[model samples]
Target chain A: MSRLAAKFEELAQSGRKALIPFITAGDPSPGFTVPMMHAMVKAGVDVIELGVPFSDPMADGPVIQRASERALAHKMSLRRTLEIAAEFRKTDQTTPVVLMGYLNPIEAMTYEGFANAAQRADIDGVLTVDLPPEEGQECSALLKARGIDPIFLLAPNSSVDRVKKMDAVGSGYLYYVSLKGVTGAGHLDVADVENKLQQIRANTQLPVAIGFGVKDAETANTIAHLGDGVVIGSALISKIETNLDNPEQAKNEIVELLTSIRQALDCGLGTEGVQE
Target chain B: MTEKYNMPDERGHFGPYGGIFVAETLIPPIQELNAAYQKYLKDPEFIAELDADLKYYVGRPSPLYHAERWSRELGGAQIYLKREDLNHTGSHKINNTVGQALLAKRMGKTRIIAETGAGQHGVATATVAARLGLECVVYMGAVDVARQSLNVYRMKLLGAKVVAVESGSKTLKDALNEALRDWVTNVDNTFYIIGTVAGPHPYPAMVRDFQAIIGREAKQQCLEATGRLPDALVACVGGGSNAIGLFYPFIEDESVKMYGVEAAGDGVATGRHSAPLCAGRPGVLHGNRTYLMADDDGEIIETHSISAGLDYPGVGPEHAWLKDTGRATYVNITDTEALEGFYALTHMEGIIPALESSHAMAYALKLAPTMGKDETLIINLSGRGDKDMQTMAKREGIEL
Candidate 1:
């Protein structure tokens, strides 16, 4: 089984929700990404979603967009991001690292080339922000052939028919965008998310990870109870953006944030002993 | 040849060029738009309403005039100008905006949003929004909002809120990003009217169908005026709406040659031009698989053009398909050549063409002299030059 499937199975047996912390690769600089990945794992993150910076991030809000701009300024490319994942794998091998970004760079590298490079780099999965299941068949096939899980997003507006289509082709987990807006925008109404999750659960057995507008431990912990995993992105990147001149402080801040969320998930859910 | 040029086979692939390469959150909205478009496109009532608005509101059947003086000076082919510049609002952009705004209304949308580069499309969109009394917002790059203040004010005067996007290489592409964000956020009540023949499925094809009226009218006019189809067709391409608008009706007419003029800022060899089909490679950007000006590592490069409308780093997917199929030829026109065409027409025909359209005019000037005078070349004069006066003045070292 892939690292993602194994980790989810472990989390389920332990009665604990997974904590997935997202940070853009090479956000402050190329050297900081690997260290940040390690820090996330130490803070009890079950999975890491590393953002592959692009010049234009249409689906992101101001916070993550700034993260991408900073990464791109540091000359971050898909190949360099893969190298970062390879570096992160030097000491940590069990955590699944999912590279997420728009499709242009992958198209530039070609699907087969990207899949080969990603596999060689120890990357576990890929969630291309712009490529839905309809447009992702060939790329998904290539990634699956290479033992890389193809992740997809499920939005609040996704109809039952669309969810069924994604459930058929999608692997790893279904990233449920918990709100109606882009990342980092909109107020998360837990009730609205719960309602949507109920609809989504009726259709597929794939693990559903809820993300978008997850700013605090309270929201994250509340969301943890409602889904298989809680994915926090813009909130963590905002910490990096605030401490760009101090990489050590940025890493510490993210670690502290994720650790607190991990605590909240454990305490709030009254689950088994914390991973740490 | 088959009488039909059927393409974008159900999956939105224009021979592997156009597809829905947008984020997952966007699929449902795009699918809704596609369904609505499929429904209303074949409905006779919708067609009649659209045709009536095209004629009565937009003042269609814009004349195809033989530029007698300009042709004599060019000294070769008798060149005819399809006066899209004379269309209401002084450009062909209104054709697509009006069509989309009407569709938005039919879809029960109360608000309309759009993105603009040179501000032509924003103004066109704002005009229709005011006509329909729908709330409108337009996203423009901060750099463009500054360069084209007059258009910014024009949009405001038309009661549309204008948002200045200050992002990476703040220009057309950034504005496009902002518009897409707005659409994803407000997908329920808002309808995004993309200004180009790019974006995911339904957009490239839908915008092409709406703007195709230009070629449809020009084809009939050319036959009526010259007693046969013109031997050649030329139009300037940015995101390639105007060019495709004029070329789509003629794609099946093998006797008519098509030329798409791209802005070669200095030259294609200079690596500064916006001629994606001529110089760049295929990549996905702004929701479609098309030719783009991206660097080796896949970073989108900033494009240079004297015309803000043609400064985009990508072209429409149909143009890419057309180029690959050898159905149409693509060429480039430098800023220097376009300026000469701009001045030549102003002096000879008393008609000033937009800098975007001047690229087509420039290519026509070079090709007209090489062809027989009996042959006819119809150029789609896409817009008027009033918006370019400041750029022209600055180019001549004068403060406007």
Candidate 2:
């Protein structure tokens, strides 16, 4: 099995909901990333989504968009992002790292080239936001062939048919965008998410990681009872954006937030353990 | 050749160019939109209402006037103007906006949003929203807002809330990014009227179909006047709507050579131009895989053009397909040459053309002298030059 599948399975065996923290690969500077990855893992992240910043992050809200701008300012490319993942893997190999972003850079690099580079970099999975399964078949097959799980997103509006389509093409886990809006949008209807999760579960046995609206530890705990994993992106990137003048301070803020969310998830999962 | 020139296939692939390359959250909204578009496209009542609006409101069948003097001066091909500049809102943009806004109404969407470059599409979209009493928001790059303040004010007068996006490069592509972000957030009740023949599946094909009225009418008008189809067609391609609008109908007419002109701002050799089909490579941007002005690192380079509309890094995906399949010839016009075309048309024809359209005029200026005078060329005068007065005046050392 791929590292992503193994990580999810290990988390399920431990009766804990996975905490997937996403940070753009070279946000602020290239030097700030590998250390940040270590910090997030130390704070109890089960999976790491290292964002590959694209110039036009169309699906992202203002916060993550700013993060991309910052990353690009530091000359972060997909190749550099993979190098960062490789650097992260030097110290830590057990934690599954998913490279997340748009598909253009990968397209520029060519799918086969990207898959080969990603596999060499010890990257576990990829979640290209703009590549739905319709255009994802060839790239997904390439990634899956290289033992890198091809992750896909399942939205609130996704039909059972769409869910099955995702499940058929996607491996590792299906990312369920828990809101009707872009990443960093803060409108969460737990009841709506729960209803969607029921449909998603009925269609796909692949682990579903819910993202887009999980902000606080309480929300994370609530989500822990509802899904296989919780993804916190803009909330964490907001720390880096807020502390652009101080990278260490931003790192500390990220650690502080993730530590609390980790505690809440561990505590909640111990008591309830994903009430599915 | 609506039957013969069926390029996008059913799934919106103009060969391997256009496809739905958006995030998962957008799939359902676009699918819902596609369903409504498909339903209304086949509905005769919808077609009747659209026709009535086009005829009465937009003043359709914009005349094809022969530029006899200009053609005589060029001393080669007799050139004709399709005169899309005479259309309502001063461009062919209204054709698509009016159609989309009507579809949005049928879909029960209360809000209409759009992105604009030279602000023609913004004004066009705003005009429809005002007519329909729908809430309208227009995203323009901060650079475009500053440059095209006249159209910004026009949009505001049409009751659109103009948002100046201060993002990467601050141009049409940035405005599109902000608009896509807005659409993703407000997909529930909002109708995003993309300004051009780009953006995912239904948009390229749907916008092409709406704008195809330009070609459909021009073809008949050319035949009626000249006793045969024109030998050549030329249009400026900024996200390629105007060009596609003119070229799509002529695809099956193999003898009618088509030219899609792109802005070569400093010249394509300088790498400071927006001629993607001329200089750039294929990559995905703004929900479609198309020819883009991206660097080796896949970062969209800042595009330069005297015309704000043509200052986009990517062209419409179908243009890429057309270029690849050898159905159309794509060329570039420099800012200096385009300015010369702008002045030449103003002097020779007494008709000032939009700077965006000036690119096509520039290409025509070159090609018209080379072809036989008996052969005719129809230049899609896509918009009026009123919006470009400030830039032109500035170039002439006049403050106003």
Candidate 3:
């Protein structure tokens, strides 16, 4: 199993939900990205989703888009993003960093090159927002051969048959988009998500992580109680964008926010077990 | 002047304005389109099908009518209208949509996806999808959803799933974003029916090629009627599809000057303009390297226009190339000027034009007064004003 999958399985068996914090790499600057990733890991994040900035991020909300824009402005190409991961790997290797972005950058780097780069960078997995499983067989095979998991998203609109097809191809974990619209638009219909989760659980034994509009601790806790993992992206990016000039403070604030949600998921005693 | 047209290179770069700069995931599909287009261009079967569709379905060879009343009122140059509005679906957008839909069928794609601003293209795409028995999905901005509910319903009625995109300013750009996302995800089985002569690679060239029929027909009609081409040819430039279509055949005709009027929503000086050719610089937007309005920081700013169709912050790359090469001149027409021209055309000639087309009309009005009486001008009436009637009525304080 991939490190991400193994981690999720461990958490699932222990009756603990995975806390996944997403941050756009090189947002504000690359200088702070590694530190931010480390801080999230320290703050009780189980899986870290490192977003690779793209010029047109259609699936993202304004907050994440602005964060991506900031990163791209600093010339955050896919090569630079991989370099950041390589740097991050020098000090830490067990965090299971998954590079999440659109397919253009990966395609720009040929499948073999990208798989090799991911292996060198110590990337645990990849989840392209736009590349569906049916078309991703080659990429999946290459990444799998290199021991990098290839994750896929399952939307509410995605049929059960389609989810099963993705389940056959996907590794690490399945990302369930909580809403039909783009990130951060609608209120989370928790009931709808619960129903979809039930449907997904019936077809695949893969660990499912719910993202899109999981803003506050309450919603995070609610999603954690149901799914194996909870992914927070737009809300975290919004905070980072709001405090861009002082990234340290933004980092602290995000760590604190995730800590609170982690505590909530653990019923208020999660901080006592921090290794650091 | 060259009698035969030269094909643009594989990159779709029409002199530096157009090129495929899309994501890696879309490259294979773009290449497929390029190959398909090259083959289809030479195939008599494809041409016959498209020709028949244009003639019967889109009501092609639309009449070039002399606007005698408007010309007499202007009292300078003779004015004529290339009536593209008379085509089915009430706009020039159907011309490209139908052609692309046919191409999509030839490519063995099962689904069609498109993005729309004013919902005109969405309706056009959905109409073609319905006709061709393909599943269609259209992405429209949530803001546009509110503004163009009728078109939204029209698209749905024609058997398309309309997705309201609420991200990134919740406008046309956002709709384009969602559509791009969809295309990336479904590129294997889906054909992205780009509404304009924009985007990466084959799209700009393909859309322009389809739309170029306008200029080809107008040129023949104008010469037959007046014994010479018009002194000036005018059309509005959003992504420059309609304008390029109307301007392409006349590029080599030095005496027949071509004008692409952009929407100066407030004014170019105020930075609230859509005049990308006149004011924008080279930048990457929507997967294509093109001329776009960008701040000193290279950030794309929001553009404003009374006409949603002309509200984009970028022009088609070909227009930027044409401007640089001196084959075409780009001009800006302000909202007030376009509005005034809208009323003038309606009152004088009893023809209501889309606000986008009014930009060209406004420019024609400005140029008519200085021209000799014998000089004639042709304007591409790209679309009917029915879509804008509600907004126009509200702006004019009409009860309806």
Candidate 4:
């Protein structure tokens, strides 16, 4: 099995939900990304979503957009991001790294090159933000050929029929955007998220992970029971944004944030896990 | 003729150029929109309603005038102008906006949102939303808001909330980014009325269909007036809607050659122009794969143009496919060349052209001089220069 599948199986055996943390590669700094990935893993993150910074991230709100701008200022590219993931694999081979971002960089690099490089970098999955299944066939096939899972996203507005279509091609997990808005926007109704997850679960056997508007431990815990995983992106990047001057402190702060969410996921404090 | 050449494939691709390259959160909404657009496009009632609005509200069949004096002065091919500048709200933008607004109403959407660089599309969208009693919001770049204050005031008067985007290069691309964010957030209630032939799957195809009226009308007018199709067609390409609007109908007519002029700020050599099809490579930006002004690292670079409407760093996907297939030729006109064309047309023909259209006029002026006097060339006069008066004054050492 792929590392992603194996990790999910391991987590399922432990009766615990996955805690996925996302951070833009080269944000805060390029040199800081590998260390941050290791720190996140040490803090009990099951999957690390390393964002490949694009110049215009239209789907993101201000916070994540700022992160991309900062990262781009350091001259970050998709190639460099894969290098960072490879660097992280030097010490930690068990942890799964999912490259997440818009598709332009990948399109520029060509899908075949990206899939081959990702496999070489030990990257386990890819969640291209802009590439839905309809447009993702070639990329998905390339990734699958390399034994890498091609993940997809499901949104609140996703109809049951849409979910079924996405589920048919999606692998690794289904990233369910918890809100109707861009990343970091507010107004996440927990009940609404639960209801959507129920609908999504009925159509797909793959684990469904909830992202967007997952700000802190409380919300993460609340969302924990509703899905197989919780993805925190803008919220963690906010820590780096607040601590830009001190890379060490930013890493510590992100680790602290992930630790809280991990504890919540493991203990089932906010709500009951599936096994519980 | 293949049925696919005129429109995008089922996946919204024009060759390898266009696709829905948006965030996963937006996929469902985009899919829903594609379905809705496809349904309404085939519905006779929907087409009838759109046609009625285009006729009565937008003032369709904008005159195709023979620029006899201007052609005589140029001393070349007979120059004809498709007077889209006379359309309501003073631009061809309303052609797409009215169609989209009607679609929004039919889709039961209660709100309309759009992005504008020069504020023409914003005003057009606001006008339609007000007519339909729908909530309207327009996102403009902060830089554009400062430059095009007149259109900003006009949109506000039309009862649309205007948001000034301050991110990225703070131009058309930034405003588009902000608008995409808004659409993704408010997918349930809002309809994004894209002003150009860019964006995700249905947008490039849908906007092209809405604006194709320009070509349809011009073809009929040309045959009636001159009794023959023009030897060449010319229009400025920003996000390329107007140019595509004029070029799509004539695509299969091998005798009718097409020219798409882009805004070359200083010149293409200076690396400051917004002529993506002329100088850029293929990449995804705003929702679709298209020709983009990006660097070696795939990061979009800032573009410069005197005309805000033509300042975008990307061209529409279909334009990319057209350029690749050799069906259409893309060229660039310098800001100085366009300014000259602007003055020449205004003084000689008594028609003040928008700076965006001036690029096409500049190219047509060059191409017309090369052809015989018996040959004919048509230019899609995309908009009027009324909105650009401030920019013009600023350039001439005067303040508005």
DockQ value of candidate 3 = 0.09
Candidate 1 local lDDT, A1-276, one digit each (tens): 999988888888888899998888999888888888887888899999999999988999999889988988889999999999998898997899999998989988989999999999988889999998878899999999988999999998889988899899988899999887889986888998999999889999888899999998999999978999899999999888889788899889889999899999999867485656
Error of 1 at A43 (Å): 0.9
- Cα lDDT for residue A98, candidate 1: 95
RMSD vs true structure, all candidates: 1.1, 2.0, 9.3, 2.2
Predict model 2's lDDT versus the native. Answer: 0.92
Residue by residue across A1-276, what tens digits does model 3's lDDT show?
Answer: 678978987776667888898989999897989988888888888999999987667666667788887897797877888999899888887888999987656766767988999999989999977666544688899999999999988876667786788789988898888775566655888899899899999999888998887998999999877788899988888778888778878988899899898888877335333332
Predicted structure with the largest TM-score when compared to the true one: 1
* Candidate 4: residue A234 Cα off by (Å): 1.3
Clashing pairs in 1: none
Q: What is the lDDT for A151 in model 3?
A: 91
Which residue pairs collide, candidate 2?
Answer: none
Cα error, residue B64 of model 3, in Å, equals: 0.8
Candidate 4: deviation at residue B206, Å?
A: 1.6
Q: Count clashing residue pairs in model 3.
A: 3
DockQ of each: 0.85, 0.83, 0.09, 0.70
Tens digits of per-residue lDDT for model 2, B1-400: 2337667767788878989999887898999989998899999999999999999999998999999999999999999999999999999999999999999999999999999999999999999999999999999999999999999999999899999999888889999998888888888899999989999999999999999999999999999998999999999988999999999888999999999999999999999999999999999998888999998888889999999999999989999998998889999999999999998999998999999999998899899999998999999999999998988888899996
**Quality class of the docking in candidate 4, CAPRI style:** medium
The candidate that wins on DockQ is 1
Q: Is the docking of candidate 3 incorrect, acceptable, medium or high quality?
A: incorrect
Q: Provide i-RMS per model in Å.
A: 0.8, 0.9, 8.1, 1.3
TM-score of 3: 0.69
